[model samples]
Target: MSDEHSPLIPASYDIVWSIVTVLIIALTIVALVTLARSARRLTATQALIWTVVVLFIPFLGPAAWLTIGRGGVPVERT
Candidate 1:
């Protein structure tokens, strides 16, 4: 038998996956933090619903929150 070995997955693939995972996690965290801080923008029920969306749907959820869901008429402050 020949002494040779090869990996089914390349090292680059692992690196790419690691980067992707980190990005997704970071996106989720940022989305949640922004959601929490925007208390005036969302009511308790709305915030809860958005939290569920952001947590359950992963990439698309957070992306949607940052883009569409988070947008609205700006609240005027005294």
Candidate 2:
């Protein structure tokens, strides 16, 4: 009889990958929501460009927006 091969990915690694995937998705959502809710900080064209960046570039897009992109905007507390 022929021998069977084992699975390529281990169970522990699968869990870790799942967590990473969820985190990336969550970060993207938060970035998009924050961008949408900004009060006149970004113009329509700028917002559209940022939306494309955040959606297409995934990890880096959202990270850049949250860090460098939003740097010049002032925060309002009500």
Candidate 3:
């Protein structure tokens, strides 16, 4: 028998939510670091564009910059 409103939260749910929350925090930190580092290598206009993208779009923006916008190539060594 269950109570009408016993704050019905399960332990599994709590664990899942905790994991999700941690992942989000970690992703946000990584995104900010990537944005800062990439911004330093870009021109003023490009940096501004990327900044807006990362700020407004969140996850996809940062991933896009790292994967696609960064030219996706390895630099040659002399």
How many residue-pair clashes does candidate 3 contain? Answer: 0
- Residues forming the 10-long window of minimal summed lDDT in candidate 1: 69-78
| TM-score winner, 1 or 3 | 1
For model 1, what is the error of residue 9's alpha carbon versus the real structure, in angstroms, after optimal superposition? 0.8
What's the TM-score of every candidate structure? 0.81, 0.79, 0.55
Q: Residues 1-78, candidate 1, lDDT per residue (tens digit)? A: 974445787778889999999999999999999888786667888889889999999899999999988785255587
Model 1 pairs in collision = none
Q: Candidate 2's C-alpha lDDT? A: 0.85
Q: What would the per-residue lDDT of candidate 2 be over residues 8-43, giving only the tens digit for each residue?
A: 866788789899989999999999888888737777
Give lDDT tens digits, candidate 3, residues 1-78.
Answer: 775443677777888988976875566567667767666567788778877776677567766766777664234455
Best by TM-score: 1
Give me the overall lDDT of model 1. 0.86
The candidate 3 region of ten consecutive residues with least summed lDDT is 69-78
Top of the candidates by lDDT: 1
